[model samples]
Structures are given as C-alpha cells and as structure tokens.
Target chain A: MPIVTVASPKGGAGKSTASIILATELAHAGAEVTILDCDPNRSISIWADRGTLPPRINVRSDVGESEIVKTLKQQDADGRVVIVDLEGVASRLVSRAISQADLVLTPMRATTLDATIGVRALALIEEEEEALGRAIRHAVVFTMTRAIKSKQHTAIEKSLRGQGVDIITPPLMERAAFSALFEFGGDLRTMPVQGKMEPAAENASAFAQAVYNRLVGKGL
Target chain B: MSDKPTFSIDLDSLKTRRKDTTPESQGRVDAAGEQHGFVNREPNRKRGRQPSPRVGQVHAKVMPNVADEIADEAKRRGVQQGVIIEEAWVLYKNR
Candidate 1:
C-alpha cells in the first residue's frame, strides 16, 4: 500500500482536485483507494457525499493533526492505496501526513505566487528526509494549465528543473470536467458530459499512470 | 472510449514499506515543519471547566435541614446538586 499525500501551502493550488483525480483514477484502474480528507474545507468529503463514490474508493474526512498519522496507519494495508488531501496552509497536519507518505505530490498552478508558496512544501520534504534518515519521494504536478504553455509557466518549469526537481509530465489542464467533479460527485466516466470529456479523462488517466509508474519504481 | 486502452494497475507490483511513526521521529518531523512555519494549526479547544449540562429547573422547596445536607453532600462528593436529586428520584421509583 502506498500513501500519496497531496499538499501545498498556497490556496487554490488544486491540491484537492489533484487528490480526487488521482484517487478516482486509481480506483478505476482496479486499486482500492482510501482518501483521507485532512482539509478543513472538506472538499473530498463533499464530493463523496454529493454522489455515489466510484467503486473501490472510500473517503474519510475531518482528519486533524492528531488523527492524521493514526488514521493513515489504520487505513494503510496491502492491496490498498491511501491518498491524503491536506489544507492549503503550512500546518502540523500537512507535515505529519507528509512524514507517512510514500509519495508527496505538490500540485501547483502555473504562477509565481503558487510556485513560491508550493515550494515551501518541497523544502519541508527535504528537511524531513534529513531528519527521518530516509528518502521521501516527491514530485510537482502543474494543475489548471492551458493547452498552450505561458511564458511564465515555461520559466517556472525551467527554474524548478534546474534545481533538480521532479516534475510530473502531462500537467493537468484547466478542463471543465476536472472542476465538474465537485458538482457531479462521481468520476469523469460517471459524470455528465462537460466540455470535451475525452481529453479530460485522457489527461487524468495519464497523470495517474505517471504517478503509478513512480510508485512501482518506474521513473517518469 | 471503448476503443481506447484504459490504464490497469498490477496489484502485486505495489508494495507497502514500513514508516517510522514513533514519537521521537514525529517530534523531529514536527521540529522541521516548525522551522518552515508549519507549526500546529489545530484550533485551540476552550480551556477551563466545561459548562454544566444540568439545564433543567426544579422549583420544589425543601426543608432547611434537608437543603443544607444536600449542599454539603454535593460539595463533599464534588458533584452537582442535580446528581443527588436524580439519585433520590431513582430511590423513590425503586421504593
């Protein structure tokens, strides 16, 4: 079982969206996924409540700093994957969750403010690695991107790469389906058609596969 | 959609590794987080004694001696006067 934590200190950086997309996609691919909604916003819980959660996906909400580690340990088991969605603040809940994560995915939109704040999560991971004496695998995934990359997006990607940061390819585009998950409650397949559903599913599927590849020790 | 190849997960390939959840390791993680301004953000629970849940009112006037005894017993037992009243009611029902 792998615990993938979606964390970012910057608000509106798509941490919740990324968590749902990954969890649902993984569940669709025949993996039992448990999502711990640690965000006070209750984004995942609301989504799970709105509609029938896709089969093989279970959502637990209101996981605070104290219960995070314990809840993660309880939910983790063979043949299951746990996804933790953290609040968009630098809090002990985020740190404690990251400490138990097999992979920490920091979702950042293509903006300077987002990158500046999201990098704090990466720095914390580095420090945690040194303290825990084990390498904590982490990567950055750009969310709410456009079909055409902006100059700022290119610059930030370049800067991060220069710093030897692992950036997940096929960044999640600003798709209507991605946002519609909150309203529809189910995955893209089960939700009503929003915009062009094909590309959205493809993007989410590939992004999840990239993550799965990493989890299985395959790079990129 | 059926024409496209869907992603599939090989369950056997996924492995779970042991993580340190001991207090010492957690303390170190917390320390590192604090250095980066990720301190405890949990909402503070209210301090001091919680409000008593005995909201019901009893208008019965007891004899002076019985009232004094009840007050002294409540104080000695460190419980609200309501507890004594409830026990007395139960005793009446049993009788």
Candidate 2:
C-alpha cells in the first residue's frame, strides 16, 4: 500500500511513461494498483480510456489538489497500491503529495535541459522535508539515457550524486516500446511489439523492478 | 471483494421525487376537473436526511507557519494532522 509519486517539473522527462510502466508491471505481478492521473494533460486517463486495463489496475483521472489527499487515503484504505502521476511543475499540490508519499520517483532525462529542471523537482521533495521535519523518501530515475553515455549524462549523474540523491540503476534506456504504450493504448505486457519490442520490454521490466526494489528498499 | 467508492451525490432522487410529487400535484387538480380524489401528501422532506451531529469536510485556512508546525508535529508523532488538530482543539477548549 505504498504511495509512490512520479514527478518532475520538466516536461519530456518521461514521468508519465515511467509511471505507466511501473504501475503496469506491479499490476502484472498481482499487486492491486490504482494510478491517480494528476497531470493536467491526462496522459494516463487517455490511455485508460483507449482500452480495458488489466484486472486489479484502475485509473483515477483529473485528480485535483482538493481531491488528492482524501482520494489517496480512500484508495489506500481499499488495499490498493497507489501511484500518483504528478503535473510537471513544483507547486502546492506537488508538495502535498510528496509529504504523504512513501516514495517519490523523479524522472530525469540525460540532457542538460532535463538536469536543471529535474533538480528543482527533487528540491521540491526537500522542501516537503522541511515542512514535515522528516526526510521524504525519494530517488531519481534517469530516463532516456543512451547506453553509450553522453558527456552530459555522466556530468548530470555526478552532479546529482554530489547532492546525495539516489538514482535507480540500469537507467531507463530510450525505447520505442515505452512510447508505444501510449501510442498503442495498453500496458507493456499486452502491447503488440515489433523487432525492438523484446529488449524494450526487458528494459521496461527491469526499470520497473528496480523502482519497486527502491520503493521497498530491496535494491539501490 | 471490494470496488471503488461511489458518490453520496445521489441522482436517483431526481426521478423518484419527480414521480412521487408530480402525480400528487396532478391528482389534486386534474385537467378533467377531478379535485377531491387523493389525500394531500406533504412533498417529501429532503430524502437521505443527513445523519445528525453531521460529519463533513471543510476547507480552512491558517497561517502557513502554524500549518507547518502542525505538519512537523504530525510527522514527529507519526500521526495524521487531522488527529493532532482534533486533540489540540479539545485541549484548547479546556485551556
């Protein structure tokens, strides 16, 4: 019944992508999962509307700040693991969710553009720590990092480590299958795949498992 | 064994209330001049009468510093802010 939030202030950080992948994987593993699609764009909402979700997985769309806390508590009370996909900005709602979170997942792409905005998102978590007088558990998942690490990616990783932020390993490599989830309107396990689908699926699963491990403190 | 929580915003009453009240009014004064057939019924008081000592939610405002203090204490005690606030309110009343 952990509440994990996928958040980043920067758009194109793969926040929605990572959220959907992790949620679907957890559901495939038989966990009852509910996704709060808090993004204004309603990415998960649109995806959910496109097809039937796997049993035990539900999507709650258009969750505003007023409704977030009660809705989250209500969802958790029903024995479902709750995942909040936050809007790509630092705001009161983001802080509120972070304060109540069991774990906060911040997605960061391997680029200078994402690095700066990504740091701000992580800082929002720190702000919640100040507000609550406790360390809010959180980590950064480097999204779209190429296997051949660019100089920018290495630099970004080193910078984050200096700030003592934990990064989920096996950085989510860029994959067509991930986007295909949105394009095809289904979970990773159910989507029809082409040549790149196998490795893409593996990456998505490993990324999800890594996130789950971090959430439970089973892995770094 | 459980499903999502539904709303307390009942939409069923719209239809039933219309049905229950419409015939009562129409039965009293029919177009055919039928005026004394049915006993006069009091239009139903608000159905789904809210339980007394009513529990409801409210949005409130306080100083940001005060809110932060409450949140910090809530975390320190591993309690919800609502619970802490409720106890503090009672203690304040006695004080």
Candidate 3:
C-alpha cells in the first residue's frame, strides 16, 4: 500500500476535504483505503460519524506526534492505501508523517498567504530528503479553484511550475457538493443532492486519478 | 452521469516500498524538521503531584468533646481525620 499524506501548514487549505475526497474516490475505484485522521480537529472522524462510511474506507482519528510513525508503519500493509490528513501547522508530527509518506500532497488555495505558508512543508521535505538520503516525492494541488482563473492564480501556478514543482492538473474546483461532504457523511454518490452532482464527481474523480498516477510512478 | 465509464483500480500495480524507520533515521528527520521550525508541538501534560484517590467520606456524628479531641489529635499528628478513624476501627476490631 502507498501512504499518501495530505499536508499543508496553512489552515483552511482544504487538507481534510482533500483527504476525504481522495480516500472516497480511491475507495470507489476499488482500493481499500484507510484514512489516518491526524488532525486534532478530527474533521475526517466527524465526517465518518455523520453517516455510514462508504465501503472499503476506514478512518483512524486522534493520531498525534508520538503515534504517527508507528501507526503509518502498521497501516502500510500489502492490500490497502493509507491517506493521512495532517494538522495545519509546522510541527514534528507533520515531519514524521512526511518521513513515511510515499507521496506528499500539499493542497493550497490559490492565494499568496497559502503559498507562503504551504512552501514551508516543501522546504521541510527537501531538508528531510537531505538528512535521510532519499528523494521523497511531493507535489502541490491548487484547491477551491474557479473556472475563470484569476490573475493571482495564474501567477502562482506559473511561479510554482517555474520552480520545478509538480502541480496536479485540473485543480479541485470550488464545488457545493465538495463542501457538503462534511454535512453528508458518505461519498458524492451516496450523499443527498447538493448543487450539481455530476461535475463535482468528475472533478473529484479526475483529481484522484492524477494522484493515483503519481502514486504508481506515472508523472502527472 | 451514468454514461460515464467506471474507473477501476489495479491493486497489484500499487506497490508499497520500505522506508527507514530506525531510531537514527528518525532522529535525523527530527533534526531536519527542527531546522525548519517544525518542532514538537504536542501539548504539555500538567506537572505536579496528583490528588489522592481516597475520596470516601465518613460523616459520623459524635459528641462535641469527642469530635474536638479527635480533631486535635489529627492536627497534632499531622494526619487526616480518616487516619484516626482507621486506628479506631483497628482498636474496635481487636477488642
């Protein structure tokens, strides 16, 4: 199993939502997914509590600094996929989780504040690579995007690309159904009708496929 | 939406690789994280002696003189009134 950690030091950067969407989408695609809800906020647990969890997905909540590495190692079995949703701070827990991550997905909104704070995770990854003497795969995903790309969004995308940062394409758009995952516990298919359901599913599916490509060594 | 092709995952294609989980490697990771200001942020536990677990109450009614004497003896001995009660129980049991 590949351990995919959704991390960003910036709060409200869509870490939980991205984790839930990715886990459910991957599970829907026939992969047994276990989400380690490492955030103190327990966003993933709350979503799981609100409704019946979709098939093939399990969530472990309240994972802290002490148990992160051990938990990741224990859950990284042969027949499952592990997705870790981390807290929104630069802490040792994030570092320890990144150390075990097969792929690190830093989800940030198209804003300068998010990029400034989110870049710290990337720096920490680079430093860990140097210390551990291994290349830790990492990428950035733009979240809460709109159809009409703002000038700031374009500039940020360009800057990140220029720095050789792997940015996942078809960035997760701002969708009503995506936000409603917290309200309705299950995946998009099982949840009640929110806004348009078709495009939301498409966006999530595409994003998960992009992540799957990265996990399997297929460049996005 | 029903017309969309089903997306299937090949479980066998997803390979899990081993990472260094040794104490030395973890120490190095911690050091690197500290350089980036990602220090341990777990909340500190409360420091100090915990409260005693003997929480039962006796609420026995006695004569004023006897209660005063018991209180004086406990204060002089620097022990709780429950200690006096325990000693009295031992004496009664022996008798």
Q: Which candidate has the highest lDDT of all?
A: 1
Off by over 4 Å in 3: B3-5, B52-82, B85-95
Fraction of the true interface contacts (Cα pairs closer than 8 Å across chains) found in each model: 0.80, 0.00, 0.74
Which residue runs of candidate 1 sit more than 4 Å off their true CA positions?
A: B3-5, B54-95
TM-scores of the models, in the order given: 0.89, 0.67, 0.88
lDDT of 3 at A211: 92
lDDT by residue (A1-220, candidate 1, tens digit) is: 8999999999999999999999989999999999998898899998998899998999898999998888888876888889999999999999999999999999999999999999999999999999999999999999999999999999999999999999999899999999999998989988888999999999999999999998888765
lDDT of 1 by residue, B3-95 (tens): 233788989877788999999999999999999999998989999877669577688799999999999999999998999999999999999
Q: Which stretches of candidate 2 lie over 4 Å from their true place?
A: B1-95
> What is the C-alpha lDDT profile of model 2 across A128-199, one tens digit per residue?
455455666889989877779999889989988898998888788888778777876677666776447666
Return whichever of 2 and 3 wins on DockQ: 3
Q: Which is superior by DockQ, 1 or 3?
A: 1
Residue A12 of model 3 has an lDDT of 100
DockQ ranking, high to low: 1, 3, 2
Interface RMSD after interface superposition, each candidate: 1.5, 24.8, 1.7
True-structure RMSD for candidate 1: 4.2
Model 2 interface DockQ = 0.01
